[model samples]
Target: MDDADRIQAASKFLLQSPPGEINDVLNDVRNIISDDDSLQAGVLPALREYNLAQFITADVPGHQHQSIVSDAARVPSGSSDEDDEQSQDRYWDPRSRTSFRFDHLTLETSDPEHVEPDSESEPFRVALENAALAYLASHYHDGVVSVFSTPGSASRFTIQIVANKYNPNNFWSGRWRSEYVVDTGAKQVTGRILLNVHYYEQGNVQLSSTHSLALALPPAIAPGGGAAAATKVLALVEAEEGRYQASLNDTYAEMGEKTFKGLRRALPMTRSKLDWDKVLGYKLGAELTNSKAGFSAA
Candidate 1:
């Protein structure tokens, strides 16, 4: 078929259909594209093109993570500018999406006999990290969580939960994080969890929402307490984490769905839908012809 016919056919196939009929339309489009070598070569790539980096640029809510350690010290260091660029490029690739953050979380305890106040020997950092991980894992089983240790003599660290979704017409990315700093002398832990969701789609649309909670809790274990005391603290932390997780999930779900509908509602309009293949084909052919004419004049 000629360029005009090709554009018309493609436009008809590309018309946005009702959500329930989307899968059937997609199968038909694929079959059509496969039958026409020119359509497969010229139009399929344009429809599939999505620049995730341009859309996933929003930072997580209420926090910025700056690590002093080099890539060699941290497993899969993603803090540097170069690393972020690489991640952005590979956002759609499944291999780059895997995370093993829970492996770094381990319970730490002080030597019961020599439990001196504010002693450097206590493993408060690891214990705190473990507590945060436990909370996240129970709630967001499919999420990718990462743990980062802060530099200097401060007894603190951060844990982040990252999740993303990519499809034919939608892109979504979210990050929720908590930073826990422990006081050995006081046997207390203080920090906050921040949750945010951001999504973008084909119609030049964007939506986002954020929620945060401040936390102050007893340490996972008392300085001099042995395994018995540690068990009690762990149970308490679990219950507390459950409460916070529920609150964050409820708020995020409500906001995310509201914005999701706001953008999708813009897609289909009017009483009758135009045949996108025909519409896009006419436009594409006209543009192509104009471009050739301009180039010849130049």
Candidate 2:
């Protein structure tokens, strides 16, 4: 069958088969596809191209979990020619460097204040914080909780939970309280959440970060955060790609130099040590003799 026919047949088989039976059918189909030279060369590339385009153009959300803070240092203007030249090249100069820091970023739904409270317990408020934390955890790959106070701090982060923020039936509003703490030892700034509540009724709930790093919490609970994790991932991906490209270039250059040296050495009698044909024949005979002796020993 043609490549398209084969693919269609495979797909149909998969659809009809039970999940447990899929592996056997898939194996058979793969064998069939690999046997076809035309399918291997043409159809596979076409399928991959289509898949990649779909992946790249997928309409994912715009928000990210982490963002890199770009810090630009102002270069002082100098009067002398040498100083002016240095000033102009500040960014590129080995001594001059720009520092980039990553912050845990988050995004939340805009506050909705008009919905009436269903009860003093504020079920919607609780639910919203949980949902937001879950979303943040899944998207950003970070452990988050609906915290009322900073883990070790006496101060609480304020959350404004308005009623009917997400749904008409729901009544809760949330605001985030964020704090920046500088760790002198690690030389990093930690953005901590003080308290996250729906703000329907202001009472403090104790919160901690003792859960797994992938904990799902409410976005309202982890207020003032969105996109920080995703931004960090993107930055890492970019840095890794750059490193890989440099290593690849270096490897290619090394390979090329080795190949050139080998070619140079392969040329006819530039050095008078030995003749190539005679040397190769002697080596082959010695290898054959050794092989026969080894076999005889076995």
Candidate 3:
């Protein structure tokens, strides 16, 4: 089409009429983009539809437009949050004996966890739970720990983990769940466990506390490249186990079937070190720990 015809076409769909000069069209183009190229290829596409709609609905025609973003700008500006999000979905898959899968990582407020609870003073407690779960899933690297979070009420949130359930090793067994109450105004979070798992075979074990504890978000660790991330999976798991065993006085969970009351009464805490060889048997192709009460070969 001729320059005159081009101008006419642009004028009609603008949802209003504008001048019919090529220079007029040039001005419209300038309005849509900044004078400089601040955006790269990936970000430009998402902006396309939003930009077109915005241009057509301009309050004043032919005004120089600056880049505009809709609600989805949660990540770094111009970096597709979706790209980061999509990649994380492929995290450790439970079905995969080889690696772990952490799912549905999001920074956007549109996510359910980010939703404002009915009360302004205390929004849904899950608001920060996501951050905790994401940290666990992203940094822990071990597919053994399943990290999940849920919003129960305006002020209630739950973050839980079931570790070493699938792996064929005794490094970690059973589950640990933590619940949090969020007070948006005071910026406080506290939690306790509602359901605890024990290996009746090994004796009832208390992995986490039933009493309320302050919400503690683990500090951010280096998010390395693929290989490094993979390496961390086991390292984090081992470190956690070391902390667990050390906390328990370098003993393993009691073995053999027993009552919950029996477990609490005086069941012996097995005086054993975390046989690194047995606990990490899966990763090392080492010997598995014999099925002892709650701890079993995955």
Candidate 4:
């Protein structure tokens, strides 16, 4: 088969095959590409195309991600640069809708919020994007609970949750409080629930402390979805805590076969519904931390 056909076969195998049987899939592709030099010729181009195809148009609520489907279509199957057919340096980030021209040393990306990758917006949003939000939100939550942190990491990860003042059901909260009862019936809960874990030098060792988030339960939660959503959410958060206290100790992100360890064991001995809070309230230049937490909540 030609390069396109061969690469297509390999990609299909990798995606469709059973999860643990990748070595076998590689072996099958190895035999095909090894025999056909032309097929090999198409590998990099096809791989790039596939890489671009891997992303779908995403429209995240509080944020956005890059996509490449449209640009990939522009390049066509088994093709190169418009100006120079031989140049393989052409690439685009679909999320950013940005094109890169290494040969010309140019970089361009449209605002994800502004441009449409396709004539019509794709129906479904990307799962990974939401997964990332959930992951980061959980991470933000964890960052607050942990005492010892990677140096300089505290500020870098603290992100602001967006506030839509216009929406009657989803407005923003004014004050940041440590008490879990810091809810004000917001139209929407759109901020980080910061648990500003304050570490103070109590002589030979430093004492770690805690903090808060302004939470607002959604309308759904107040009505019927509370229990089901709560179960799912609290589980997610507890999972995150266990992960932070365990694997997060060193920073190699992992999942499955969960375990828990020191500090995490005792700290909030209760399982409050994780869904009770929407996210990390990241305000632009807003301080959520309180005084005596050793850092100025300025």
Tell me the tens digit of each residue's lDDT in model 3 across 1-298: 5544443444443322121122333346444444324322323332333232221111111222111111111112344566554332221111111121111111111111122333421222223323444555764443222222222333222233322232214322333332343332233445443223333335533343344455322232222122333233334433444454464453333333343446564533675445555656554443333444237543
Clashes of 2: 35
* lDDT scores of the candidates, listed in order: 0.41, 0.33, 0.31, 0.32
**Models ranked on TM-score:** 1, 3, 4, 2
Best by TM-score: 1
* TM-score, cand. 3: 0.25
Q: Which whole-number lDDT from 0 to 100 does residue 216 have in model 4?
A: 39
Backbone clashes in candidate 4 total 20
Cα TM-score per model? 0.36, 0.21, 0.25, 0.23
Residue 37 alpha-carbon offset, candidate 4, angstroms: 4.0
Model 1: pairs clashing at backbone N, Cα or C within 3 Å: 7-281, 10-277, 11-276, 11-277, 11-278, 12-277, 12-278
Best by lDDT: 1
lDDT: worst 10-residue window of model 1: 102-111
Q: Evaluate model 1: give its TM-score.
A: 0.36
Report how far residue 162 has shifted in candidate 2, in Å. 43
Tell me the spans in candidate 4 whose CA falls farther than 4 Å from its real position.
1-8, 14-27, 44-46, 56-298
lDDT per residue (tens digit) for residues 36-107 in model 1:
656544443223221111111222222232111112122333556743422322211111211211110011
